[model samples]
Target: MKSRFVTGTLVFMLVFGMTLAASAEVTLRHWDWHQPRMNIKLKYMAEYEALNPNVTFDTQVIGWDDYWTRLMSGVAGGDVPDIAQFHNSQTQAFLNHLEAFPADVFDYDRYKEEIINFEAAYLFDGTFHFYPVGIMSGLIFYNADYWEAAGLTEADIPKTWDDFVEIAKLLTKYDSAGDIQVAGFVPNGILGVFWLDLHYQLGGTLYGEGAKTVAWNNPAGIQALELIESMIFEDRVSEVGFLGFNEAMGTGHAGMAYSWSWLGGELDNNYPDLNWGVFRLPTFDGKLAPGPVARNNHETGMSVMRSVRQENKDAAFEFLRWLYEDTDYLIEVNLVLGTAPSNRTLLDDPRIAASPLISAIAEQVPYTNIPGEIPHEVENDYGLGMLQDLLFFGYPAADALATAEAEANSVLMERAVKWYVEDLYTPVTD
Candidate 1:
């Protein structure tokens, strides 16, 4: 059953004149980061069904931990669904599984400004792979009570790493037995995004255009690592990996934690008693490091399976346009799933415009930078997690970055070599 049959009535709303059959049924299997939350995914599916009356959306959600694995397997086995959400990082692997089309994919030029001013991570030689959803950027969340206890007001938030160190020091408190009661900061989790952004702020580039090599050994990289090290070692202002990032942020164990805006709702909902607010990460020498952009900052997007028949392919993409470009559908995503719509035109939708959490994220759109556009996949792999765990175990900053860089480059080089051997690409080493 093709989805067109199930969604026949909705065709009336489309500018096109084709009407689907009443019994035309297509099951759209869409994959995303989390198993769709009860109220959220169901609400959208119900709305889509009501509008179309002919299509059925069968959503197969994988958790963040299992998403990549499930997606990669499906792709490799050619068992991918009608559509699935993909991260900007996962675009390469999934692109090989997507159907190609003529240039005009929803008038890309018309939404040029909405392209999110960073290097398009999903582009492989200018062939756009995924339809971006929403924006995600780094934010520094502070426990206001802790800052006030340290005799600092919201006005005292630092603008530089140096100033932040001072504030962190002031906020750190210890019990008589020498156990740290409250840490000035927590430095893991999404703070990893801060790693690349801060490297640029510290004056380093991961890759140079002419040379397809990793350049993390530069001075800026050293400085960035040193800054994180200073907070844990010299200043004793942070509890690196003593607890999970969420736990630290929620329980008031940390004064500040670098996280995404989406966490604001989680904090407000779960920790109802915690007094906190969000701010952009501090800058260096008065210049702010641009925040990293994600495919969707809050909620993700779906892509069609390359193996689906051409007609089904068209149907999948048509549904995608309706799901993403349609204002009503986009608003439903925001309202039901806590997603900030990526459709530039939806910025005015009262549903999204009214959310202060989503709006705060919207405010940072001008500062978003997509992470490295290199084709190799990045594995969170507990490197930051392990490094933070070992911070208290006395690992030096240089040693930590050196070890992590070596491992990271090893993984990346392996992939690069594989792609080269397969004639998919080549490295430009100088």
Candidate 2:
């Protein structure tokens, strides 16, 4: 059901609407990086066009790798799409170029209250530059067949890190020579999210007071690295690169993998026959107290460009308001995202209530921290990304974090957050 947050504006639109003739037609140019999402958006665009006959869409779906390059260059050349996809990670880079939610068109306070974690967007500057469609957070997706074969049941779902380790051992398979053949839990590509989740769970923060430098070399950080190191070495439940995460899971060689809710859509699309089950990330002490279970990353649909002409901008905002106000569209797109709606109104909808996967992820929303953008090199190449390699090469936990700290700080020095939200890391004390 559409909430009162939007129903009133929708009624106002209908009551004071004017039909635009073909002579005054408008074509809003839109761009996004995901083909599946674009597919969903395109379907809704058709519905939008039917309602406002004079407004049509010119859309483009760019490859994710080339998306920002093409977009930044386009913006610099004064050829920016009227509406472009947005990610909070790009807030520092594109915040100025994006338009805030127009006060006349949108109630800022309503959005702040209606969205599940609107405070998560403190990193997106003070403006609602993008429409946050959903929030993405980590989850452990397991191979259902493997779980059954291991003689596990719903009672076996892990509630804590210790429980996960035991289950992973039972799910592991060994080769003739005793080397691992099938992994019980794969951490491939987890990178920053994995590191940060574990770190935060134990009361670590990524930055110090000024947000000027690294603050992740402390006790909690070391413990997080130790836990991962032990998982790969002493526990031996998983090999560093055995068959890879998604590939192994798809082929039934891996029992579980650490990934975001978005993986649901990817796995469904790419591995149609794989039987899978997901659980929200396990906690440190078998409870939510000490810290959040995981960190969340906000997902945006389309950010209107502040640089666009008035007519295109007005039309773009009008269409976006209508697009989100539709209940069916929200439900379908939430399915496409593999998450329940970010809109609080749809949380109790039958579709979300019936899906175990969505329900599990939704439970974690309130507990997840929206740790601001992790830098590319900091998360990937020379920082947390290198921890596994360091661990594989026999680096001690403290030394591994020290190594990552130095490498990550080099990037932090250059990419210090322009603004930092202390609440982003404030733990759930309850």
Candidate 3:
């Protein structure tokens, strides 16, 4: 058996086309946060190992909250995985330590032409360190049992918000004591994001002239807030102080939920017994969906490490090239992770049209706006987070919206991200 050796870094000598001794084996370590996705990766990695005959893997899954912190520590200690799974939003935290895709090896122009919103996956500085595999955006997720008990079917999927409100009333369940048991439509924790979804549908802007700060206090935005108010307060189909967005949906206490695509995987992982269905967030015009319907962010990335030895770096990228370029793997990632594949080629594949969750996401791909990562404070505290203040405390929607606008602008102006974004699709096809 070949023995391990080190010079400046641990040398695996696993370069492409290099002959390996029969007994010599190398392990490539990879780290990610999501268990559902990692399951898919592990399956493929097993196949990769079989084909190579001398490669094995050390796969690690960390919780989302502590992943970055742990990764940062690993980098500083000079003990890091050869490949790190990351979200595009977390790039600035680790970009300097990531190896850029070699210029001559991969066709950059083909990536641009073949991938949807390719630019959003990379930095504005023009060097590509991370490549996003797919995108996650807002969708309407409903409990199928509740839907059927309410005498509803897929034919009842709404063309507009007005139709959706009527359906929400049907899905809501009231107990014998006359208290809400199952809310028809619970925005609870997700109120902020779906609110932005509606605001964009109504032609509102998140920032002002030069994109320096927030400008969400306009007529369209206030109208969107008022609509939310009517649904929660006037229609009586939803309630405040209910379980949070994920809890309600996963536990079957919410008849319908407005959340991102990842909720599908979460529900699958945590609540496998749930009977759920998905539809695109309804349009405002009662016609085809139009531009700027929802805000989306990049998801699922693999970064080759700058710290790995030269031979290991070459091996890692070679494996990654196979992973990213493989259409079957691309399709499977979206299926398991509930994301829309970034590969434009997948759009025409029959598999893309088969999965309801992925199809909903793919249909809206043309209409999404990626305005970088929204300031967390604005999304959770100052802006969309103000829904409770309005509904529970009776704060006036217009005035509260104005205050939120001011606070969001303050936060946006101070944020490090430049706020420019890419638009990939709007519901133009079937």
Q: Per-model C-alpha lDDT, please?
A: 0.61, 0.80, 0.79
Most lDDT-accurate candidate? 2
Over 1-430, each residue of candidate 3 has an lDDT whose tens digit, in order, gives: 2343353223435532244454357678999998878988999899999887677889999998888888899899988899889776666567789999886767788888887777665644766877668887999999999898888888999879999999999888889997789888988887767888888888876666555766677898789888988988888788768888789999988889899998998999889999999998887886544567888777757988899887677778878887887888878888888888887788777887998899998887777777665667877787668755654567676777788777777777677555355332334443
TM-score of 3: 0.88
> Could you list the CA RMSD of all candidates, in the order they appear?
7.9, 7.5, 5.8
Top TM-score model = 2
- Cα lDDT, model 3, residue 147: 90
Q: So what's the TM-score on candidate 2?
A: 0.91
Cα error, candidate 3, residue 179 (Å): 1.8
Sort the candidates on lDDT, descending order.
2, 3, 1
lDDT of 2 by residue, 1-430 (tens): 5688599988777666643333478989998888888998899999888888888999998998899999899889999999898877778888889888787887778778888667666425456778868777888999999999889999999999999999999888998999887788888656445877888788777767666776777899888878877888889878766765677777877888888888888788899999999988898878875456677776776888989999889889999888877878877878888876788888888998887778887878777776566777877887878877777677787888888889988888888876466455555666
TM-score of each prediction: 0.78, 0.91, 0.88
Query: Cα deviation in Å at residue 2, candidate 3?
Result: 34
Scanning candidate 2 in windows of ten residues, the lowest lDDT window is: 14-23
